[model samples]
Target: MTTNDEARGEHDAPSSRDPQDTDADEYRTTDQHEATSPIDRRDYLRTVGAVGVLGVMGGLAGSATGSAAAQADWETEADRRIAEHRQGSLEVEVVDETGQPVPNADVDVEMAEHDYGFGYVLSANLLLNETEPGHPYRETLKEDFNIVWFGNYHKWRFFEENQEIADQATAWAKDNGLDIRGHVCLWANVDAWAVPGDVVDAMGVDHQSGESGADLDPQHVRDRSFEHVREIIEHYADFEYEGTEYGSVIEEWEVMNEVVHVPGMIRAVNGVPGEQESDDLDPVTAPVLAEWYDHARDVAPEDVGLATNDYNTMEGSLEYARSAYERQIEFLAENGSLDYAGIQSHFGDRDSAVSPEETLDVLDRYAQHGVRLRVTEYDATGDDWSDEEKADFFHDYLKTVFSHDATDAFLVAGGSDAHHWRDDAPFFYEDWTPKPAYHVYQDLVFDEWWTEASGTTDDSGTYATDAFLGVHEVTITVGGESTTEQVSVTDASGTTDLVVTPGTSTSDCEEQGGVQVGEHCARDPDDDSLYEDVNGDGQTTHGDVNALFENLDSDDIQGNADAFDFDGNGRIGFSDVISLLRDI
Candidate 1:
């Protein structure tokens, strides 16, 4: 299924090397050194007819990519193509949800790992600034990831316990331009280590009897839960120093988390206390859940997107999971409080791995309700798999997610294995060396799906460009500072136009790896793996050809063979392969 910025890292090699290896540089150059013959497009086309294009393209298809120098030459051509297709200008228009142009506003656009944001669960300690000097992969989040959710860390009680650490985590993410989400504000199991056990237990135990074993009052539990949530959100979301209001750090939040798991203060579902057989709540539980959602929504400012978050809510194949989500969507849709329907997709066992079709179906089903969607917590946990298999899983799974228009973001529940919520994550190992998933992620996010370019609009308030299908951060620069908004540069025919005003200021906007003029930074063309042999067989032969073809029409960084486009055209065609054979 073709999805949206619907595409999809490497790990640390050395900080001293190119930082993008940390995510900085991303341009591919052709392999042609001064000693090698230049690429001749006409000759390549002529030879393709004589030798047959398929044989040329397929013969050494299984081989590795071209030599370093040849790869560089191809990279140069690819970069040229990207530049050539840069029909879209840097100016983008800001609009409210109603589609009206939001003019003259301070707009800031930055790219998230996923259109939403992707990475693992974040611990305050994982932050570089939060850690002591010489922490492992200090810039890993800044380099590779775009968002961090505090699953095991940054909780209400945890914050009260470790405000400094939580503050540091927020500071680091804010500094690096990463988005953030708070896991849970309220849950039935608040007594479980998430918040202060003493506080939650005290909420239930009455001192009137002068004993710890007092019966819990549902209303009392609800009141304390409300107060706790209010304080946390007020502290983080609507921060104030003295009478001056500081901007909020968290823009999105899990207003009611795992409501189906245990109805915290709700006490009963349809008159049943602690209904646990399935995720669906009884009539009693549903209303109470909605009340909590309303309360949380009321506590947060209008800018905040309050989400109804749950695990396995929409695997489709699972009967209870689908039923539970359907109920939640129905209830939230009615309440008009469902800003985001957060789904947790944890694929632990092979059987639990939902197909792309099933995942898309589920997401679409929810989309019909007109609610914003997010994959709040996700992890594909399969054992005894090769590195290639893991990488392949990450690519295909995300492709399915990216293809969907409603997908706001996708976050993995874990990051590094050493500091993971579970056993493993696709991007990291215990040692912090990037896994295969990391490389594939880099190719997709920074390469195939990323468009680093610039253009100017006509007399009309519009700028257009031919962009690959994906979500983009279109930052319109006004004055020296910049304003950014997330926009979609789609694959539809013709040019993708943005409707924002760029200030006349000549100040240049900062970008990650692409060439940058004033107010525009074309995502830097990746040049890192340009000369890499696909199969690592030490030759550019059948294995390489096979790899390139497999990725044909795919925006996958490891798949697209722009370097093989000998004609220096935007695409890889018959002539490109002939040119490769000549080089081989």
Candidate 2:
């Protein structure tokens, strides 16, 4: 077996230098790192103080900051970066249908979803099949996160056997309004578990001897790989189920995984020319890898993002991993085949913990490559560490990554111990109860970073506020009339202008011993009416109540609370479901 040291190189050993010694200036710089305008450092400081970063940083004694001043400096810089990169001004205008300004209108802005992806690994099997035991997993994912990638069902081996399950999960995700990123089109690891045995047999080359059989055809290997890529990409790009076409639900696909560590397919395509030595290293700019990416680009939709994913690049210790990743990124970027540089930020038990400052330094180094960065598979699984220690690390690390301008998304490798590859690494315990890390995740992603504001429109019929970049629902209420519209806030300084006409109340539907729900009248369950069938099962049934119960906390139920207020309450709650159940 090839040792990691040998696969990298003798001189390219892990770095032992202190993170403070590593300067961002030493690497290539980009405009993304520079502040576009002056930021209020005091505001950032106050924000951090209110959020209690001091408590999160308390256990981080070995952090890059040696003194209180250094700690404060790091915190200020992080907050400043977040303010400079993540926020934008939102301006909403309310007007009549005749284009007249409706002054003094009440406006409420609530964030629907983040444009920046915050996600975790998902289990398709458990998600679709397991019910009571998996309720927390499903509900937490639906409520707390906005994106997901299947844990194993999307891999080549598992995908071959469970394509139906994977498709069902994809459909479910689309229905739930969650973004799905393709985990991998190909995993280049030489292990049998990664690459199917038939593919290895098709290669017809002995990995040990590097000897090729008569069936050794390089073109055939390329064709087979390309076929798989094309099939997976095209199928998901326009996935269809039950007469609904979920067009391009998956927007990103990892074209190749772990190319540096194991270049087995690269070797297979190169004709397996010589004896396979454990210590032999492949060229950093392997032509076959580039060819694979080019093929993927051709097969994928124009808007879909393609990435090269690998491990150890962001750990702040493995110099070889960093160097190899940088070279691969350079090669791919020059070839115009790279959209994202995937950083599998897995901090294992034995690996040295990278401080927040060091993590920033790592991001700075990769940001210079000009490709968007993603913390694709992040986990800090230290078995010996206490829960508080884990939580502290998660809090500090998420803030640091989310603060950086180069990073486009941050995804945990797994969220619950029940489905995690490493048992100790998940944010939740096996019983689906939250660990401290889970609370940290929630506090940062939802509470602190989220945006919600309300104000009355002035003479110009406008209400404006600076908010974090994302899709927000804006509701304009004039007198007792209200209208809601979703607006996308995409840029830091760019203004998202939304014009909404106030909607008037109307009771047009004919009531039949039932309540008026939205524009339609919902009759009693015994009438078996077509109205208010929440599950869309063609008629009212007990299943509709079950469906409403399952999605009580979801955005859909809360957004349309008035329509589903079966209990005649002003708000959506469990009592509404109980009332609906009793009616049935």
Residue 498, model 1, lDDT:
52
190-268 per-residue lDDT for model 1 (tens digits): 3234435444444453222113444444555566667877877877764433332224667577766666554544543
Q: Put down candidate 2 lDDT per residue, 1-584, tens digits, no spaces.
A: 12252111101211332211211111111111111222222343345543565476465554433466776777788889898899999888887757788889999988766778998766675566553333666776677777887765666655665677778888878666577888778864423233444565545544321223324556666777888888888888767777654456686998877777756566667776212333444645878788878988998878889987777787637787888889999999999999999887766642445777888888888888789998877776656667766666676678899999998899876535544555554566666566767767766766678787999999988889988887676778877867665566777978767766676233322322434333222334444432255543224544455456566677666866666777664777655654564454
How close to the true structure is residue 570 of candidate 1, measured as C-alpha lDDT?
58
RMSD of each: 19.5, 13.2
Best by lDDT: 2
> Which 10 residues in a row give candidate 2 its minimum summed lDDT?
22-31
TM-score of 1: 0.59
Q: Please report how far candidate 2 places residue 546 from its true position, in Å.
A: 23
- Write down the TM-score for model 2: 0.73
TM-score of each: 0.59, 0.73
